[model samples]
Target: MNKDSTQTALLWIVAAGFFMQALDTTIVNTALPSIAHSLGVRPLVMQWAIVAYTLTMATLTPASGWLADRFGTRRVYFTAILIFVLGSVCCASSHTLGQLVIARVLQGIGGSMLLPIGRLAVLRSVSGEQYVSALAMISVAGQVGPIVGPTLGGWFVEAISWHWIFLINVPIGVVGLFAVHRYLPRATSTAAPRFDLTGCALLSLCMIAFSLAVDAPSQSHRAAWSTGLFALGLVSALAYVPYARSRRNPLFKLSLFREPNFSVGLIGNLVCRIGSSAVPFLVPLLLQLQLGYAPLQSGLMMLPAALSGTLAKRWIAPLIRRFGYDTFLLVNTLIVGGSIVAFALITPSTPAIVAIVVLIVFGAANSMQFAAMNSVTLKGLSHEDAGGGNSLFSMVQMLAMGLGVSISGTLVKLFSDQWGSAIFGFRMSFVCVGGITLVAALIFRQIKETPPAIASPAKPAVAGGR
Candidate 1:
């Protein structure tokens, strides 16, 4: 193939991988209730199915770049798709909650590598001038996935069996595997540095421990175990500080935190996302269980948010240039938080138009928040620090997502148990998570205002993992 043809083929290959990953992220949300019923478990308890996938992705994502460097991208990317397909098969075959969670973990292992490695491949293949444009094309695939995922999942569940959700990936992935083998350049592997095994383990353990600590009260009602896990997580996090200082090449340099915006952005992303991340998980459940909507109807309701979010992306760069990151993030953070809190008012008696307006507002604000937050976080990094900094940022993003679901599920379980009302539980969960999001506005306050620079084409926001 000609050089142009090769690049074109590569773009499609990567975009397909991204589409699969992004599609899986949101598609499961609308299907959770059905999956729970099929597996003989309560819908609220199904957070593990989601949490397991996200947490596994979080645990392994830091290693993706290294694995790609040590092994070739073509090899790694192909294997990722294979594992993802196998995992999907397992998921479709699962007959119990535990089985499904395990399958999700397997799926996440593949998902963890897809975007990062695909991005890396494009970076290496394309020239600097083409890099941004290439990424923009790939990102469109990510966007399309969420827009269609919930509705597609709903349709599959309603018209066919829920197993079709997983089965749908089979043909797409099989085609992807062939395209990868035929078209992807076999980039030569580099002499990679020794990975920070200790640092990676400590960080992974911290994420898992904290997530389990949050989830334990809901799962086992074991306060002592939860407390112990929380303590362990805290200790592990602290331990990484000294360990990184001692290592020649830590998983992430502690100095990355020295950048003011990066630090604030990281912290803000973690705290703010904890609330907003729960919405996709909770909203479908709310629509179906509390409002008595069918799965297809509930999925259709998400169209407003998904469409508004995509449309809102074009407004982010101009808004940031006008308002500056500090102002934009501070005000938008509150808007996002307030929108989340507003979800509490969406009872059956609420007009459908009212719900749609609220979703549009939240979707737009949340989309802007992600673009500003991700750009500001990475913008300040030195060229040397950019790769590691981005990897760490991605890790925090996934961890926060897992934490969000864990925390939200625990809240719902606690409130419902105490109030003996599921709808009331959903209401209070929205309020509590929304309050958690509002706290990030205070974190954004720490951002130092800078003069606006000329606007550039926006890089794709991190996948919302909806």
Candidate 2:
């Protein structure tokens, strides 16, 4: 095969890896209740199963580039697939929530590497002119995963079992392992810089502590310990900034923040995503808990969000081109926030048709929000700058996911307590999570202007991949 054909094959392989990672992460959200019942735990606490994986992703993402630079993407990528497959096996066999959380951590150790290393492989192999096309191609998997995940997981739980949800990953990961080994290239290290073990350890501790604190139960007797852990997390996280700024070969280079767009984009991506990301978590509960829907039905309700999100990605660039980045982000953020608040109005009496319509709009807007923000944030990054920026952005994305889930779980708990009714429980949760999105709209005010379109030569597929 020609070089271009070989590279395209690599892109597809890496994209599949990313899709599996994202699908496995989201597919479980709807399956949580079933898993909870089987394991005999409160469904609310099952968020840790997800929290552990995302927290590990946030912690390990910083080391991705450094590892690739040290060992070679080919080796690291294979190891990641192996570890993920092992984790999946363990997850399928898990007997308890505690065991499940540990399995997620093991799953995380494998998953945390997929996107960055795969993207790095693409970044090294592709031309600068095609970077946008490559990124857009890979990001399409992320969007599609959500659309398919819940439905697929639900089907598995219904026709087979929840264990099948994890068992499913094994075959996909197996194919990925073989494909990556054959297609991935070894990066020739010119004089290697020393890896910063100290900084990596410190950051890992900070991320772990912070994520645990976020996931901690609000009314649990362990609340005080959660507070202390969060405080320690903050101190360690803060300590990394100056220490990174001082070192030549720091694990995370603080200097990446020097570019205004990259800096604002990363932060803005995290904040904007918190509210939007939490919706997938909140909506299923509102359906299953409040509306008394079955696991299969609740999971099916997520279809519109996925479908509309896929469809809406096509219009994002044109909309941004017309309104400019600042204007598009501001307005879209409001729409996404308003849509979240709108969920508070959903009830059993609202009529199933009306409810589906509302969710479709919400999914479309949220999908647009993701596509718009990702393109805007990445629009200005240079080729050399892409590695660290991409790594940082990926880390922040996963971090926000954990935080968003934590916040959603906490709000539901807090609201349920305040109102003493499950109906009001979800109602209050909707308002708070929606309000968080509205508050984040202020962050975009910092963006100064938009850049000229650096259009790709090859057209990437739209959100739904059609």
**Residue 29 C-alpha lDDT in model 2:** 83
Superposed model 1: Cα runs more than 4 Å off: 218-221, 454-466
Best-performing candidate as measured by TM-score = 1
Candidate 1 structure quality by residue, lDDT tens digits, 330-369 = 8999999999999999989999999999999998898878
Measured with C-alpha atoms, the lDDT of residue 76 in candidate 1 is 94
lDDT of each: 0.88, 0.79
TM-score of 2: 0.91
Clashing pairs in 1: none
Residue 414 error, candidate 1, Å: 0.4
* Tens digits of lDDT, candidate 2, 66-182: 777787888888888899999999999999999999999999998888877887788789998888788878887877788789988888888899999999989999898888877
What lDDT does candidate 2 reach at residue 347? 85
C-alpha-based local distance difference test score of model 1: 0.88
Q: How far is candidate 2 from the true structure (C-alpha RMSD, Å)?
A: 3.1
TM-score of each: 0.97, 0.91
